[model samples]
Target chain A: MLKIIQRWFIRYSEQDRKLDKAVTGITGRRPYNIRLYRLAMKHSSVAAETVKGFKESNERLEYLGDAVLGAIVAEYLFKRYPFKDEGFLTEIRSRIVNRESLNKLAVKIGLSQLVEFEGRKRSNLSHKSIYGDAMEAFIGAVYLDKGFHFTRRFIIRKLLMQHYDIEAVIETTTNFKSLVIEWAQKLNHKVEFNISETRGSKHNKQFKVDLSVDGEVVATGNGFSKKKAEQDAARKACEALDIP
Target chain B: MLKIIQRWFIRYSEQDRKLDKAVTGITGRRPYNIRLYRLAMKHSSVAAETVKGFKESNERLEYLGDAVLGAIVAEYLFKRYPFKDEGFLTEIRSRIVNRESLNKLAVKIGLSQLVEFEGRKRSNLSHKSIYGDAMEAFIGAVYLDKGFHFTRRFIIRKLLMQHYDIEAVIETTTNFKSLVIEWAQKLNHKVEFNISETRGSKHNKQFKVDLSVDGEVVATGNGFSKKKAEQDAARKACEALDIP
Candidate 1:
């Protein structure tokens, strides 16, 4: 199984020799447990008709992979781009793990070439969606085969680290918190987000937000809803500061 | 363009010997015109990005495939199971076109093998999602390759025509409408969904609902005020009817 997996990937990595080499390198260091990876790639449809002795498809892995991928991506994006706000991080994360992007990564990693099937009719279809799913599965597989720490290292080095461009990212991005924090962080300053007042009794409370830096209020906003008001205030602060 | 298209699918179909032989049995030709069939297999993501000189992706095909797959599946299920209601149709559709199912179809069609990508990493990934996505894309591809008439025919043959055990499906299914209407519809059914009044109507409006399946009034419900009341009333009627 390990040999089959290795040979399959080695043949599939047509675009980038480096990526192919990386996959081969992993197997060489210690033969990857292909079972986990295979299960990760399983699709439920393929698993559905199997009477018995069937490899359960990747549904379980997809569930686990979603959480694993989300955590890893969230952590890396959170710390690497300290100035970035929630929205900024979300967009990049979306860009990174969205179906299209996942597909792209799968293509990059050469996971699509290693899929196996019992039937022949539907075998020659596109692997874009599967590639992305499998990539996530592969990540999940690595974590299982090796460990989280090992998987984390692979993710950071192979995917995230190379794409880490905080300054360029901030410049290109347009999230209020991200822009403000990113700019402030760049300028070597700290930002203070304080809810100056909460009005309108507990029954239907309203928050008054004052966005400030260095004890100077840059923006103020209000909402029947506190969160909304804070977001509005933050947005205004970002604009007025003209930082990003 | 059509000839080139025909040639493409013929070559593609040939890769899966069984499917190729099966298709050839129908067309009795080595290369056949299957533009719509190919389009059905196309994923929307691929179609969207094709202008980037990467026309091989199935993203767009996936989009159209989704709709085609849904419609055909719904129609077939509707006919096959005379006792099944709208809800039953919906459930079956969900089951058939769901991410897991489509991935299986993709695998069945060997769609992952047909996708043109830069390398095998993508293919090595879960062919399930791509298979499913491509299954939708394949449906889309079929729509384009064979047009609507043949596409629907193919759907029945390939998907719904197969014994679905829809009677069993009906028993296990929940029919909200039936639950609401069973009592009234059975006993002089004259249900009227009247909106008595609406208040605090914003983007997402709150509705007032009343149940009067027959000339007899059954119930009234209030939610967020009125609309919620009507829905609750309908829910109550459903319970009274004793339809799961």
Candidate 2:
């Protein structure tokens, strides 16, 4: 039919083909609607105004993607860790989908290169979550174009299977300080991290942190920065108390 | 086939028939997996120990259901308000799914009756989100048994369409205090609520609240309780500033 030929012509247009090729590299499938992928890459910083005065950006898509990602990850973790408690599942899910992790994942998957933004206005952007936000928006685009089951498959196969090492992700101690603080709060115990000592020159300084619980110094740690020292102390404290 | 007859026989068994009838009233469909529905109704307070010594309760289901519910609601709101910003979408979604709202929704849908818990140990349960938690677990059960699309249809048709008046939900001023506080924090403005006055006798006392922004009193409201008075003042402030 004429409509079919017209659709094929539009899909195979020079610009559309270029976009399709780029998107296919990341998603492992040819886009059903290249426009959605384009919109996914269009950051709010360089958003265009529609005829109705609405800014066409990836923010709405990001919101949708965030929810989809959360659900898929929750189900995945639930099935994988059948015997694990809900608290452990929640903790691990957070670790995987946190902004820092998403940002890194986006870069790892070559998604960061596709995101379009006003480079000059980068400094005005308060949060360093643009790449992660775009990754989420891309997911939203996939969901809209291909539906939930297909999107879930893409996320599991393309992203999780190809990129993430689950065991290593679980073992990462990046958030030990917050974890220890949360554990203390649950037990109704007061936790304090104090910088007990400083050593070496200004540029090459080592900070020692003492982690106290209920006025008792339970653990000590040393590192190049105060935050690092605190986290190290918290990790030690977690080990001593069997917090995990 | 013998297998098909066996499946049908099990589905219509006496006890299953009763559960199917009760659950059909809520979800408008006979459960594909009756055991999941049973688990969904089982509260942690009355959880049975599995052969592996794990407590069998609705907590895991609640976690899964929470994510699924969030995704479905996010998508619904996204499509319903195409022109609305992400912040507006987020606010409305939270208003719809927050603990208080979900608790009320659960009771409204008659899901509270299906929940099994220890009545004597109710005080020890602490959080009053049992009904809401069971509602979420029920959703997880539906998701696992019937899959995402069927669950989405049930939520939209049985829950949102039948029970919720979206306009009234949007107009509800229950969370005005938290909304105004959030607004103030975003703008880096100092907000304070002061008890301006207390009047009348003990049984019929009226509390007056003055809501201030950046050291200036913006609104005043009176109610029977201090919390109510603060909410009233916050609502007035929101109206004065054209917040919504």
Candidate 3:
């Protein structure tokens, strides 16, 4: 068929073949459309402008991929923890898909090697999430190249099962401050962390934070730094409120 | 053949038939599993507890459906607006899926008729989103019963095409206060609305609100109530900052 020949011609280039091999090394399958994977690797730092004036980058794909990933993960957790409440499922899902976790996952999966970005711009603090963003965009590429069922299989089999240990992911302690803030948002409660006390010397300082919800002091925690103290207080407050 | 007979027997009951008809009316297809639809209609206010100590309600389904609906909508918008940026797509998607909009959509789709809740508890302000919650649960039910491709078609053809005008949905104004708050959350900016002044008589008073983002006053607005004034100020601030 003419269509089959055209497809073969598209994949005949040496550059396309190299991209195909790299993507296959990562995803365990050859990309049907090498163009999607190419775009997925393209970071906004070195985006190409199309003739229509649209800067071609991975952002749009990232947005779509984020949603697909969320849905797949939601269903996965829902089935895995049938007895757990929605809050528990939400908390665990967030732990798995948080920016930091995704960044680590991307690196572990060999995505960092394939991602294309300006070398000079890599040192900027904002580029820390570049790999994670690219990972999501790569997911978008998979979803588009295949379909939802195939994409779901790829995520669960290739990504989650191969890379992540679910039990360890559940046991890992995350930022309690963010947890409590999210809980407060859901319940429409205002949360504030106040530095109640400072003790010890300046070089070896200890900070105490009082965590309040709805103007009521719920818990207090002490740590070596303000951020740590706030996180500690938040953890205690979460326990007191039975957030999860 | 035995499985087909079992399915027929399951749908033979009068109550099952009514529910099947109702669900068919909304989704344009008979559910493969009517039990999921039944659970979808079960509101938490009148939840039934199983022997395993699990409460049978729509909450978990709502969570899953929320993710599925988000993914579907994201893809729909992505393909529809290939030239639009992610921010614009996010804003429009939020406009379509926000609580108030979903509540209205639920009512318009006649989902309110199928949702079951304690009538006495319905008067509570928190029950305002019950219909929307049920709509999402129904989506989850459909996804479970029919799978993703069928559900996507049902949403695009039945829910979106039949009930909503995309142009009108886009043009409809939403709560700017929530929009600004969401934008601030993304950018790690603190937003505050300060009542700058009160004028006119007590019975017919006017409130002036100054909206500030990250400690800088960006805009001010006047209205009959503090909430209204804050919304007005937030709207102006959104325009000033070019947020979507």
* Candidate lDDT values, in order: 0.57, 0.86, 0.84
lDDT of 2 by residue, B165-206 (tens): 888887575779989988998989999999999999999889
Query: When superposed on Cα atoms, how far off is each prediction in RMSD?
Result: 26.7, 11.5, 12.0
Q: Write the per-residue lDDT of candidate 2 for residues A123-167, one digit (tens) a residue.
A: 545455999999999999989878899899999998888888988
Stretches > 4 Å off in candidate 3: A1-6, A9-13, A51-53, A120-126, A173-244, B1-6, B9-13, B51-53, B120-126, B173-236, B239-244
Task: State model 3's lDDT.
Answer: 0.84
Candidate order by lDDT, highest to lowest? Answer: 2, 3, 1
State residue A222's C-alpha deviation in candidate 2, in Å: 26
Tens-digit lDDT track for model 3 on A28-98? 77777788888888898789788444789999999999999999999999899878767668878888888
Model 2 has a DockQ score of 0.51
Which residue runs does candidate 2 get wrong by more than 4 Å?
A1-15, A51-53, A120-127, A173-244, B1-16, B51-53, B120-127, B173-244
lDDT of 3 at B13: 71
Best by lDDT: 2
How does each model score on TM-score? 0.33, 0.72, 0.73
Residue-pair clashes, model 1? 92
Expressed as tens digits, the lDDT of each residue in B1-244 for candidate 1 is 6655656655444535554453444323332445444444444344543342234445545544565565456545544654433443455667666787556555554555554333345546533465666566555555555555676777776554453444554443235444565656566668876666566648645666667665566666545545345556676677665544
User: Fnat of the models, one by one?
Assistant: 0.00, 0.80, 0.78
Task: Evaluate candidate 2 and give its CAPRI docking class based on DockQ.
Answer: medium
